[model samples]
Target: LEPLAEAGVDAVVLGCTHYPLLRPVIETVGARMFPSGLTLADGAEATAAELATLLTERELRGAGPGGLEMLVTDLPDRFAEVASRFLGEDVEGLAVKQVDL
Candidate 1:
């Protein structure tokens, strides 16, 4: 509150997943200085919904024999360490592709 009051911020984001669970506290503080605060779950759900719509519109659903296509903003030096959670060990490398919206 003191920092935001000094800095004159009108909005802020609460990044931790648990922070949103304390929405009341966050909202109260934000209301005192900012217009809004959001949790990770809120953004995640909204993004997931959007991705679902994109998949439906593109007729891209379910895994193919080749499995799910992986795309990245940049290929990390440690691909397996990063990709394991979402893509798993099966995907050895990311075949780079570019898409323009």
Candidate 2:
């Protein structure tokens, strides 16, 4: 990060789905390293938009609020708690489908 900052990188792509969770930490570190503000581009939103465009182009998009299906290799006790953070919604009633991997 320091090297990139020194190189004067103007923007950084939050490439991973998990990267947004660390945004606060990343912003703090970036503020210290980069005297000028650095732009954080969310790859997740871009990916979702691209997926939607492709689906629409192929006329494969469904109408109505689609149900969520989560497949996990193993279901943890705190799964709902953690998943809620990602989805930004209460998922207490959501069923967890565990699959054998």
For model 1, how does the per-residue alpha-carbon lDDT over 1-101 read when each residue is reduced to its tens digit? 66875676655565544454566776776565654532223565567799989998898966656444644444544444455654445445655443443
Which parts of model 1 are misplaced by more than 4 Å? 33-42, 61-101
RMSD of 2: 3.3
For model 2, how does the per-residue alpha-carbon lDDT over 1-97 read when each residue is reduced to its tens digit?
8888989997999986678888889899999988889899998988899999999999999998898766666564377778787779988687777
Which model scores highest in TM-score?
2
Reference-based lDDT, each prediction: 0.56, 0.84
Query: Candidate 2: worst 10 consecutive residues by lDDT?
Result: 69-78
Give the residue spans of candidate 2 off by over 4 A: 1-11, 73-75, 85-88, 98-101
